[model samples]
Structures are given as C-alpha cells and as structure tokens.
Target chain A: KDDTKKEIMKYYWTSLHTTLANYPSLPTLHERNTLYHYVISSASLFPCGDCSIVSQKLMRKYPPQIGSRKSALTWGCKIHRKFNEEFNLTVPTCDDIAASYIIGS
Target chain B: KDDTKKEIMKYYWTSLHTTLANYPSLPTLHERNTLYHYVISSASLFPCGDCSIVSQKLMRKYPPQIGSRKSALTWGCKIHRKFNEEFNLTVPTCDDIAASYIIGS
Candidate 1:
C-alpha cells in the first residue's frame, strides 16, 4: 500500500502537468492538482457528452438533453489513458481528455 | 466509435465538475478536460509521489529526489477511482485524484 500510494501520488501530479501543457499556458501546481482530485473522486453526473470539455461540439449534435444539478453530483472526470502495457497506443500523452460527464451507476 | 466518443466526452466534462466540488469551487469543464488529457497521455516521469497533487505533503516525507524536467514529460496523472464495474469501490465519485506523475514506459 505504501508503494501504491506513492505511485498514485506520482501519477496524479504528472497527469496535471500533462493536462495543462495542452493549453500552451500551464496552470498552477495547486490549481491543477486540486482539480485533479475533484474530478477523479467526483460522482458520475448526467452523461459524458452532456458536460464535455468541448460542450459546444456536443451541443451542436444533441442539445435538448443536457444539464441537471442532480446529475452534476454523479459526474466524474473522464480522461483516457492508453499505455504501452495498457493499450499500446503510447504517445507520452493520452489522445484526448475532453471534459465530459458520467452518470452514476 | 461514435458512441465511445460520446461517452468519452460526457465522462471528461462531468469529471471536472466533480473535481471542483471538493474545493467548494468549480472549474470550467474545459479546464478540467484539458488537464485530463494531459495527465492521461503524459509519460510516467520519475515515479509517483515525486510530483503529487499534494506535493508539500510529499516533500515533507521524501525530499532531495524530486523534479526533473526530462522526467516531467513522461509523467501521467494519478487519480484513484474504483468503479463498481471497474473495481468495487463504487461511490458515485472516485476515491481521490492526486496530481502525481507517471514515469512513461
């Protein structure tokens, strides 16, 4: 568990750096890390596309079915990761992590 | 693929909201999702606990061997989530998502 905790911490921080790097403007370490925890542990709200990072794109496709405070409580952050051992699509960074929502199970 | 994409988007955005909930503040879905992609795909740098979301907590314990820009590029985000379908720690939201780094393989 010690090792797992260490590994978990390392993975979480690095993920934040990588997440902010895409914007060409890096977010503060605290900002990124805090946000990281929020999403990971957050509940699955409504659905993914309903509250995606790129919502406009999703809205264009489906507009009528989005938004609900109750659903918000159940949403979890969705970042896709594919490692050499995990998915073999190694690229140092995941393909894309559009901020989307996940409904609770 | 279309359905997968839809699912992915929804999951990402909702995650941000959940993440922000922890701070009693909310980050835009865009902010969270962008960060999500970075951590997901970034290479694992050094090891975890080196650059954790709660770094001060880590620095107190393990000092002297943290931070290496080269390693930075390889680090991935670390968020601990146990889904009912994925793991058994199902709790609407994940356990925690610390901003730690992952040393890429």
Candidate 2:
C-alpha cells in the first residue's frame, strides 16, 4: 500500500510536469486561464493535506504563469523546486527540469 | 524514452484514480464543479492527441458523476475501462478498480 501510494505521487507529479511542458504553442488567453485554474484546483484537491497546504501557499505567492508554454514550463519547474525544498529534497536544476519534462523538443 | 513515457501515463491515470476515489464527503457544489472542470481540462490537455480526443468523447457521452466520492470513483473506473478497450487492452473489473484505487477506507 505504501508502495502504491508512492507510485501514485510519482505519477501525479510526472504527469503534471508532462502537462505543463506540453501546453500548445500560441494558446489563447481563455485556454491559458483554463490551465491556470486547473493547476489551482489540482493543488486544492491533492490527497495529502500537508502537501495541499504547501501547494496552496506556493500558489498564493507565485501564482500561475500564463504567458506561453515555455513560461508555464519554467514556472512549473520553479514551483516544483519549492515543493522539493519543503521536503528537504535536493532541487533539480532548471536545465534538468527541461530535459526531463520536455519530450522531443 | 518509451519506458519513461509509459511510466508517465501509468502515473497519470493512477493519480487521477486516486483523486476521484478520495473527494471529500459533503463536497460543496462549487467543489464538485471544480472537480468536474478539472477532469475535463485534464482530458483536453492530455499530452497525446488521440488520448485527448478519446477522453473528450468519453466525457461528452458519459459526463461526470459527482453525487459522491463513490460515484466519482465508479464513473472513473468505467471510463478507464473504456479507454483500456480502445487499445484492445483487458479491462479491470469494478471490484479490482475499487481494490486498487480506494485507499485506507
């Protein structure tokens, strides 16, 4: 059960990174707004209470970047780093984030 | 790369399953609306186009069941079975779905 729980967390974050990295180029303002809300809603609904609270606080401070796909990806990486630090984990560099999340791009 | 891609997909669905299985009891209408929109937005922004299209179609046809967390979980399992059948994969039974996704309850 612990392993499954860990796997779910791993998948959730990786899928989130994949989503942020793959937003369409030249997205409309409405689409960007949708993505922003999606992120907020996701954090609000995270299964873990402490993780949810930390995500909410981070979101309150940083907000969602809606400028472009690149901007969203960068913002996502920075937020992920903040989250990592909350767990006292070593943060991945920006380049490593890009290399890992940006597929075939 | 293929393996990583597969891993991402695996996690994505599992995380989604986890989310649906764990929605708060006595959720407000607003919270339910947010969850419904989250599912729709997630399907639209899925990394793969074909997967996105199929998810969209499934949502359009089936919509979301927000009566309770149990309802959401059951709907999620049915939809996942549909997705599985798309690739000619074996569908997990509803009992298996409950066993897999329902955590500590």
Candidate 3:
C-alpha cells in the first residue's frame, strides 16, 4: 500500500510539473484560473488522506502562482520541495523544474 | 515527443482513476464539486494540446458524474475507453475499474 501510494504520488507530481512546464507563457486570465482550480482540486482530492491534508495546508500558506508558465512551474517546484521536506525526503532543487519536467527540452 | 506524451497520459489517467476509485462512497457536495473541477481542469490543462482539445470536447458531450465513488469511477473508465477508441487503441472494460485502479483491492 505504501509503495503504491508512493508510485501514485510520483505520477501525480510528474504529470503536474510537465503540464505546468508546457503551459502557455502568456496565459489568459481564464487559463490562469483554470490552473489555480486544478491545484486546489489536486490538494483536496489526492488519494492519500494524510498527503491531501498536508497539501491543502501548504496551499493555504503559498497559493498557486499561475500568472505564467515560469511562475506556475516555480510554484509547483516550491510546493513539491515543501512536501518532500515535510516528509523528511531529500529536497530537490527548484532551479531546473522546467528543464526536468519538459520532455525533449 | 510522442512516446513522452503517451507516458504522461498513462500517468495522468492512472492517477485520475486511482483517485476516483478511492473517492468517498457517499461524498459531500463540496467533495463532488472538487472532483468535478478536477475533471474540468484536466481537460483544459492536460499537457498534450491535441489530447486536451479532444478531452474538452468529450467532456462537453458527456459531463463528469461525481455523485459517488461508483459513478465517478465508471465515468472515468468510460472516458478513458473513449479516448482509447479515439486513437484506435483497444478499449478497456469498465466493469472492473475500481478493482483495476485500486491498488491491493
């Protein structure tokens, strides 16, 4: 169960980062709102109860930044880093979030 | 690029299905709304532009069913099957969505 949970989390984060990395550089207001809602929904509906709670709390502390692709990607990396810190995992650098997530970049 | 997109889609769908499988049997109105928004955001912000467009179209034709775990799971499976069919891939059976996505179920 634990392993599966970990695998699921990996998938979720990878997908999210990749999506953000590919987001429009000059997104419209509606597009930003949509991405914001996606972040909130992810925090609320994530499969792991404990992780969900933690994510919601973290979101409240640092809301998603969806103004642009760079902002969104940075925000995602920050959140992911915080999550890792909370669980005592090795923290990843936020500097290369786009490079890491973007395929064939 | 194609292979990477396929891998990302696989991850996104697996995460989505697993989350739906673990959803509350009798979800609160807020929970239902959250999941609904998640579905909408997914259709809108998915990394693959073509896939996202097709998903948005399908979602408009058949809006997500978030009334309960079973409803949500079945809806997810149906959408996934439809996506596969769109690409001429073998469609999966929806009968065992919960069993398939729910790890150790």
- Candidate number with greatest lDDT: 3
Query: Is 1 or 2 the stronger prediction by lDDT?
Result: 2
- Compared with the true structure, what per-residue lDDT tens digits does model 1 show for residues A1-105? 445433322333233323333211334454444443433322122112222323233323332111332222222122223111232333233222223112111
- Candidate 3, residues A1-105: lDDT per residue as tens digits? 889777767766877888888789999999999999998999998888888998899999999999999888888999999988898877888756555555545
Which stretches of candidate 2 lie above 4 Å from their native place?
Answer: A1-8, A99-105, B1-5, B99-105
Query: Which candidate's DockQ is highest?
Result: 3
Tell me the tens digit of each residue's lDDT in model 2 across B1-105: 666555545655766887887787667898898888888888888777777888889989999887788788888988889987886767889888667655443
Q: How do the residues A10-92 of candidate 2 rate in per-residue lDDT, one tens digit apiece? A: 55567677888778777898889778878888888777666778888999999988678888888888898998799776788
Q: Give the lowest summed-lDDT range of ten residues in model 1 chain B.
A: B69-78
DockQ result, candidate 2:
0.52
What TM-score does the predicted chain A of each candidate obtain versus native chain A?
0.25, 0.84, 0.90
| Residue B102 displacement in candidate 1 (angstroms) | 13
Sort by lDDT, top down from the best: 3, 2, 1
Off by over 4 Å in 1: A26-105, B1-105
Over B31-89, each residue of candidate 3 has an lDDT whose tens digit, in order, gives 99999999999889988888898889889988999999988888898898888888786
